[model samples]
Target: MHLPPKQGAAFDPLSEAFARDPYPAYAALRATAQPVYYAPFDIWLLSRYADVQAAALNPLSLRSLDHLMSADEMAEERRAQNWHDMPFHARFVQFSMLNADGEVHQRLRKLVFREFTPGQIERLKTGVATYVGGLFDRLGGPFDFIEDLAAHVPGLAIGRFLGVPDEDCPQLRGWSDDIVQYFDIDRTDARKALAERTTKTFYDYLTDLSKHRRRHPKDDLISRLIARWDTGELSEDEYISTCMLILMAGHGSTIDALGNGLTALLRFPDQRLMLSADRTLMPTAIQEMFRYDAPLPFFHRYASEDMEINGWELPKSTKIGLLYGSANRDPEAFADADTFDITRTPNRHLAFAAGPHFCLGNHLARLNMEAVFSQLLDRYPRIEPVTEPVFKPGLSLRGPKSLPIAVR
Candidate 1:
């Protein structure tokens, strides 16, 4: 199986123009290439909404952990960068949910699902509301919402929920930022050093916390994982990996969602007013935000076997990239795809992904957004954009690094 021959030049996913704004390029690809497009990036891309959704749902054809670097390559990269051989980072390939498949994925997911249940998130709503209220009350004049409000709210909530000390929240935030910065396409030595240091610091802290939890069990998720570790249900390394995954995914994605959501709302005043007037629209608005500007633009998967998709033959062991941001805006699936309409019905966006690898923290993220926006609208009835939103430069996660806003 092969894609239909292109009438024109094949789409290049790595071009500077496409990197800057991929929607138009995706549109062109969808028009010219089949649903699956073989691009110059050594990967096939699923551009259409249907194709992307199907790929996400089909685990046999698509596997996340398979796309990551091999153990040898990962080790070589670490040594090349002069980074420490920490157990945490060393086993990152084996320890992360993104690197797991089949039964292994199911088991790790079950542990996380038990901890981050709907009830647990519902119980967290009040805390989120309180934190948002306090942050809103303290803000004066113009401030970067991403840094000042959006970023801190989720970090604080995650820290409190994880039973991490309040003092450690700031450090965790720094580590998250460093990790993100390290993933920047144009990384520098200084940035790499900072990321390594931050990662090591976090590993040290979590390692100690794991020991403490073993001695003094608590009701938190970390303690639960530690309990499983003791019973041989979960390995020691797995426990630490789970904690890191929660901390990073819990805060990192929410931070991006809030910042991006707020920017979208401010950019579209009519939508904002519509949502503010009727709070019922908040949920839909959050969904639209995820669709409009997904926290993660794309996620990687690898083809485990030779597969034919939309007339294209995907060879076994081939890496495939799904562009969620592009797929969300596919004109075939979304009416007026470019516009920001909060009350969009049947908004089945792939922002949280699909199938087994679906985000376990989706509920928490939505709850956080709803709580933050509820308090934000009530407290600052006259909130307005103070500065142009600045998007963080990364092909993976799409979010504003800085979003300045003023509340009167």
Candidate 2:
């Protein structure tokens, strides 16, 4: 009997060192020239840009294995993953527009797809700008960029879009953080309890909010979803799940992107100076930032059928982890993958994973980054980091934990 070499042995995602710099490990994984089998998770990790892209574009590469697994099998798998006990997390977070495939994915996606279209998201630009501007107006001295600024914008922007009260946005942020933390590799019992508790609380809040929308429909995502539910187009679980998905997906990810972008600018002052000189590079710079440090880096897919990828044959039900952060920094994909160039052309980065499940809130996330970075450049002539930024330690998410910046 032969054993599968643990190629992922060096990849310790839970370590603080990895959080500070995972690119080195990612590079090593990609150098192996084949998918690395991580025995701990029983999954093959795809690190190269081409491999990740292939897996993402392959229809057989599914987000959820429920389609192929039987009820008992799924239950057993969930139990193995410690994902069985949480009823609310299983209902809402486990099965969502994000995890569904085929017709089911399309149907759930279309329900709120229009709300995220460029034009629709564009409408909220003015509001986001106003909100971010107000935040800057109140800050007169040095502050933690993550907690003080980046943390505030995404929640309010997404909250307003969902018709969540501005006052409740802070609480929503807390709920989102707690729930999202459990999605990472470290699923401790404490984290699991927090995730379930927050999920239930969030579900309850959305339940009450949906009731209000039912009584008096408003011009918000929740109201629109409620209308769909009333028309038999959506189930009660789907409605709540969709709302929770939107808030959770958009809130923390955007905040991380904002912080990562700022940290990039501060670290590569030359790039920041170039952006200041040529404001037109903001869009490309935003893309570069996402590529440089993708907030949501590790996403998994299960093979629905046998598939050949990067010279390796994967059997049915095989789990493949797509390292988006690593792909973005792959040298073959970008001329100078490691360099943070604001003006890099033809940057087809997978910061937002490609194919059917490409991030729905991508446009909104970009708009938020543009508004915040643009304001930072316009409002303050000199911005400097007060201390070394410490990134949130996780494989699932990437961003500085806090970034204290002095602005004038």
Candidate 3:
């Protein structure tokens, strides 16, 4: 019996050093290859902007919705861990768009698109502004912006969009936190237990909400999804899956962007001040922040067929990890890439991804960030970081877990 060679120092993608600051390691990794580099953990890392972008768009090369994890693997690693039970896993398996492909992905996306259109998102701006204003008005002295501010807004806004009750906002936030924690490799049994409990509770609540929407449809996204289900355009499983995806993805990514974007600004004060002084810079600044400190750093894909990319041969069924975070910082793509410049021109970042699966909530995420930052600067111009921003323990979603700041 032979074991895989002990993970090499030259390629530990999940190393503590790399996690703390992955830019330097990514740069080193990118220097070695164009499309593929054999990294520790038996992972194939895609780092260059062109390669990452290409891989994301090329569905024939990289399929997003394959069974990346085996049944035995899920049972032993995920289930035996006693984190969550069969029903919880079943719900996620049935409905998550991340696990769907081809016709299913397209149909589900179309249904979701009808509900989350630009007009609906535009109407959400005032509500988001009002929510941010109220939250910021209550803040004084020092606070953890991630906890006190960034995390709350998206969950609240998403709740409103989905017609989730006001009292359930905190519960939804708690569940979202737990679901995210399940993705953390370093997560403890306790965290898993908590997440499992939250998963059951959340699903029960959503089930009840689904029932309610069935009886009394309203002008909410949930109602629209229910309408589709009634017309036989969407299956019951699809409805459940789409709703869960919208609730979790819609809120989680935006929360990360808000927290991560603010942390980036704090790390570079000059850039922060530039945006603070000139309100007009908010839009470009938001794009730069996304490019500079992407919340969802990497996306996973399975190679659908044997292919050659950038001169390297890849076998079919290879698990490819597209390093969007690294690509955004690639010097070959962006001049002076490592520097956090709010004024970066022609910033074609793959933060929201690209191609057929480009994030449907891109506009909403941008709008929410712009609204929050613009309101924060307008009311309290003296916002500054008071402590180091603590990042979450997962490479998948990169953002601060807590950001302490002083705001006048």
**Clash pairs of candidate 2?**
none
lDDT of 3 by residue, 143-223 (tens): 888888888888777888888876787667777776766654455777766666766777778889989878988788888
Model 2, position 322, has a per-residue lDDT of 94
Per-candidate count of clashing residue pairs (backbone under 3 Å): 0, 0, 2
Q: Which candidate is the best by TM-score?
A: 2
Q: Number of the top candidate by lDDT?
A: 2
lDDT digits (tens) for residues 52-102 of candidate 2: 999899888999988889999999998888898999998999989998999
Candidate 2 stretches greater than 4 Å from native: 1-4
The predicted structure with the larger lDDT, 1 or 3, is 3
Candidates ranked by lDDT, best first? 2, 3, 1
Q: What is the lDDT of residue 41 in candidate 3?
A: 40
In candidate 1, the residue pairs with backbone N, CA or C atoms under 3 Å apart (3 or more residues apart, or in different chains) clash, namely none
Q: What is the alpha-carbon lDDT of model 2 when measured against the actual structure? A: 0.89
Model-by-model lDDT, in order?
A: 0.75, 0.89, 0.75
Instruction: Report the error of model 2 at residue 87, Å.
Output: 1.1
Candidate 1 lDDT, 173-225, residue by residue in tens: 77777665554334567766666667677888988877776788877777777
